[model samples]
Target: MVGFYNSLYNLAHTHLNDTYELLTSLQGRLSPAQTTTLMQSTSWDEIIFVSQRSPRKSSPGLDGLPYEILDILIRVPCFHGLILTSQPVRFGSCYRC
Candidate 1:
């Protein structure tokens, strides 16, 4: 049991390190125009709900809304949008939460 947990921890660390390296390489390879386009296409609106309490305050004209409700309202749509993107979420033996 201890061995299994240790192995999982090590695997998670290795995966995170590999991800960081890959992202760093990808960042270096992007052109200024491509970076600008990427930034423009990415949604900042979703961030407002995640980082703030109210989605109404995010866009204006709203009520006493909890972040949990705001997540259901906007965050689910953002997740579905990500699923429809070029690089969809991979679900398999490769990654586990």
Candidate 2:
């Protein structure tokens, strides 16, 4: 798992660094494995979205979802699938795979 994490870190070094810092400061008390899982499960897009929204406190939130603070728990990568929710756009629906 460390090897896999290392590979992912290499692929998204800066973003992963920011995520690691945030995770360390979290009060939720997630285990190391859980943290890794969260990182691996999340998408780069969601991370950026949350970071951007944090500063704005956008009204009604992005994509009609909950506030940006809750976005962290929405599960990375998963939120991308969720963005197309309640319609023809289910998980992995965009790729038609």
Candidate 3:
């Protein structure tokens, strides 16, 4: 059992490292324009639309914030302003809780 666990751990670690390396290589190969497009700041309308479309019972994220709460928060004027003014550093990424 101990050996099985060790082997599983090693396999997971190796897979994670390989995935990271592949992502890094792919990122390095992207053109400046492509990277810019990927990191483009999203619009409030787009966010609101996505939030509204999301399944109500979907699992909560790491922060344990509910999807319903996010849906409500996204419509707030201050939140819209913050998202509009912020710079995007990564693809499909949002502010951490």
Candidate 4:
């Protein structure tokens, strides 16, 4: 059991490092127009539209929050504010991030 976990961790770590290197090599290759489009802030309508288009109950995330739940949660003012500020909620911390 322990060996399985260790091997899994090692495989994930190696893959992530390789993926990071590949992405790093592609840096500064974007056109000026592409960079401008990527840098633009996403609008609320865009976010809501994406959420609506996503699968509702078929694939829940690790946190078990489905797109439907997420869609509803984001509609609330407080959660909406958190999303806008980009402050993710830590498991038990008030504001670690």
Candidate 5:
């Protein structure tokens, strides 16, 4: 089963070779000011706003934390600070696969 999966994965990966990115490309990019704005630390209000807007019944992610738990977690000051200052986790190009 593993061998079969690996063979199919390799075949699809070779055929795509990142052409998937091209298909999803946006027509334009952010201006320098817009980029800077986006890169700024997210405020707690922004976090709360986004969390509240998320679906209540959504499934938990790989970390097994649901949006409801996340909303609660952000209310803790230390946790909120950690979130604001934390660097995003970088994953390999094929991490999604």
Candidate 6:
């Protein structure tokens, strides 16, 4: 039983590492122009709509601001400008049971 558990843990750890590496490589291949175009083409209305669709009770992101705050921020014109000028977004690791 213990050996089985150890093998399972190792397999999961390896899979997670591989997935992260693959994502990093893929992101590196995206050109600056492509990223800029994507950011510029995104509309504020679409962002707000996605935010509205998010679960209200979900935990806050790295900024520690909840979805409700984000919803309010998206309504302000300056918020959209801030997002457009901000540095490229980074993804944080999430651990699940």
Q: Which candidate achieves the best TM-score against the true structure? A: 4
What candidate 2 gets wrong by more than 4 Å, as runs, is 1-56, 60-66, 84-97
TM-score winner between candidates 2 and 3: 3
| Candidate 3 segments whose C-alpha is farther than 4 A from its true place | 1-28, 59-61, 82-97
- Say which candidate scores most in lDDT: 4
What's model 1's TM-score? 0.24
- In terms of lDDT, model 1 sits at 0.53
RMSD of 3: 9.3
Candidate lDDT scores, in order, read 0.53, 0.57, 0.68, 0.72, 0.68, 0.67
Q: Candidate 1 or 5, higher TM-score?
A: 5
> Per-residue lDDT for 1-97 in model 3, tens only?
9998898778556777787888877744878888899898777777777777878877334445567877776667666664465443355777554
lDDT of 5 by residue, 1-97 (tens): 9998888878555746466787668558788998999888778788788888989867335555678887876777656654566533356522121
The lowest-lDDT stretch of 10 consecutive residues in candidate 3 is 82-91
Q: Write the per-residue lDDT of candidate 6 for residues 49-84, one digit (tens) a residue.
A: 788889886644565667888777667675677554
Evaluate model 2: give its lDDT. 0.57
- lDDT for predicted candidate 4 compared with the true structure: 0.72
RMSD of 4: 8.4
TM-score of each: 0.24, 0.22, 0.45, 0.55, 0.49, 0.41
- Once fitted onto the true fold, the runs of candidate 5 whose alpha carbons sit more than 4 angstroms away are 1-28, 59-64, 87-97
For model 6, the stretches where C-alpha displacement exceeds 4 angstroms are 1-41, 86-97
Residue-by-residue lDDT tens digits, candidate 2, 1-97:
8998888768555677787999988877888988898767545566557556664455334334445644554455555554434233335555331
Please estimate how well model 6 matches the true structure, expressed as its whole-model Cα lDDT. Answer: 0.67
lDDT of 3: 0.68
* lDDT by residue (tens digit), candidate 4, 1-97: 9998898878556777788899888967889999999999878888788888898675434556678777877777667766655555667865322
